[model samples]
Target: MKVSKEQSDANRAALVKAASKLFREKGIDGVGVAEISKEAGLTHGALYAHFPSKSALAAEALALGLELANKKLYGKSADEAPDLDAFLDYYLSTRQRDNLGGHCAMAASASEIGRQDEDVSASFTEGYLEMVRAFENHVAQARPELDSSSRGLALVAALIGGVAMARATQKSNPALSKKVLQGMRELVDEAGGLGKK
Candidate 1:
């Protein structure tokens, strides 16, 4: 029996979504084609039909993860924050840090993308740039007078780095996570204050 177009699309989507989550949680090298197929409840051969190879799937999955992260981090408008304090609090909360299921894909996988082939690296690069754009948008809205891509890039780097560090030390030193997050909060606050001049 031949599958309808809708069915085919849904099957492919399943592989994409499953692979995205696996890529974030397990890294590109950590997950295999068979594992992705199994998670999606499709036969391993079905994966090849949808994605040219695991490398292609890695690219797609990275995009999917970053898209989800964008939605989660920047989904709110400036109206949501009464001040920068609230904004930073919501931005670096443990809820976003610990929940890979709904967090940014770049946070979960960018560090490891360097290990993948060129195709995978390109996907990560594109995704990382997009994430930076999203961050720039938020920073602009938060402080319109002081706009600079360099500042935005630094903020994104600090946010990603802080969150990652917080997670890494959470098991051994829970206080370290909060300290790292608080340090970033102060940095953004100081920058915002300086922008007023």
Candidate 2:
């Protein structure tokens, strides 16, 4: 009847991973603790042992999702700047739009974060600022003439909004979804001065 520290850590990680994927696929409000526990191959009681409440688990899960996405976009090291063109292409692609459970947390849960607890909101804000800082560094290098901070914020907003809109219209209006992605990509390209000398 007792668990090792290693096993406990592994279990907690599993719970977070499962919760992150499920929350992205179905909104946070839509998932129950039992389902998350079941998905993680743990008991409902085990979930409580790791996290005080579902909201606590949700906050950790959201942080994990955002961290993973940032790593994917920016690479393992902070010194590495992402290629804006490649980032735009992948982010606005139908592939990312359709992969609900495996994309950025911001776009997946943007509509629901406003209703979540302060901890969840703080996690979202931290993740978002981390992304903006990385983007700001990249923009500063690429276009020193531009206000990197403002451009970074604008790029992130457009990227998150574009993906969310594309996903919302994907099933009911595929054409419009594609157009939305295209328009966002064009906007980013223009803003970043991608095609210019």
Candidate 3:
């Protein structure tokens, strides 16, 4: 009749994980609490036990997604610098483009975030700013001449926009989708001064 602390924590994690994946694959509005509970192998009542509402769960899920994406982009450790060129290569590839449920959260839900509640928007904004800070720090070290803040903002925007556009057109215009990815890659590389010695 009772649950252990460890079990409760695990259940909460499962709920957030399931919500993150499902939200990315299907927009937040498109998914229901029952589906997320089923995906997590928990009951609908269990979801409410951890989260007050679906929006609360969504906020937590988006935060988790962003954290995971950041770790994937930059390495796990904060001291290590991100390889901009390598990052571009992987991010722009069709593999990432086609992986809707596992790719960046920003790209997957950029259009939908504006319609969500403040908590969701706050999570999205914080995640986005964290990304910009990572880029800014990298630019400061790699190219002192360039404005780190400006370049950082630009690179993040380009990356998110690039992926979003590529995915959007992938079904209707495959060639254009490919071109969008390619163009954004070039733009990011040039803006970052990626390959210069």
Score every model by TM-score: 0.82, 0.94, 0.94
Candidate 1 lDDT score at position 51: 82
Worst 10 residues of 3 by lDDT: 188-197
Q: What lDDT does each candidate get?
A: 0.74, 0.89, 0.90
The residue-by-residue lDDT of candidate 3 on 10-82, one tens digit each, is 9999999999999999999999999999999999999999999999999999999999988877877778877
Q: Per-residue lDDT for 65-180 in model 2, tens only? A: 99998887787676766665666677788999999999989999988999999999999988888878867877787789999999998888888989999999999999999999
Candidate number with the higher TM-score (1 or 2): 2
lDDT ranking from best to worst? 3, 2, 1
Writing each residue's lDDT as its tens digit, candidate 1 over 43-151 gives: 9899998888888888888878876665554555634423334446766787777776556677677588778889888877776676567556656776777775666
Candidate 2: what lDDT? 0.89
Query: For model 3, what is the C-alpha lDDT against the true structure?
Result: 0.90
Q: Count clashing residue pairs per candidate.
A: 0, 0, 0
In candidate 2 the C-alpha lDDT for residue 98 amounts to: 96
Residue ranges of candidate 1 with Cα displaced over 4 Å: 76-87, 137-147, 192-197
TM-score, cand. 1 vs. native: 0.82
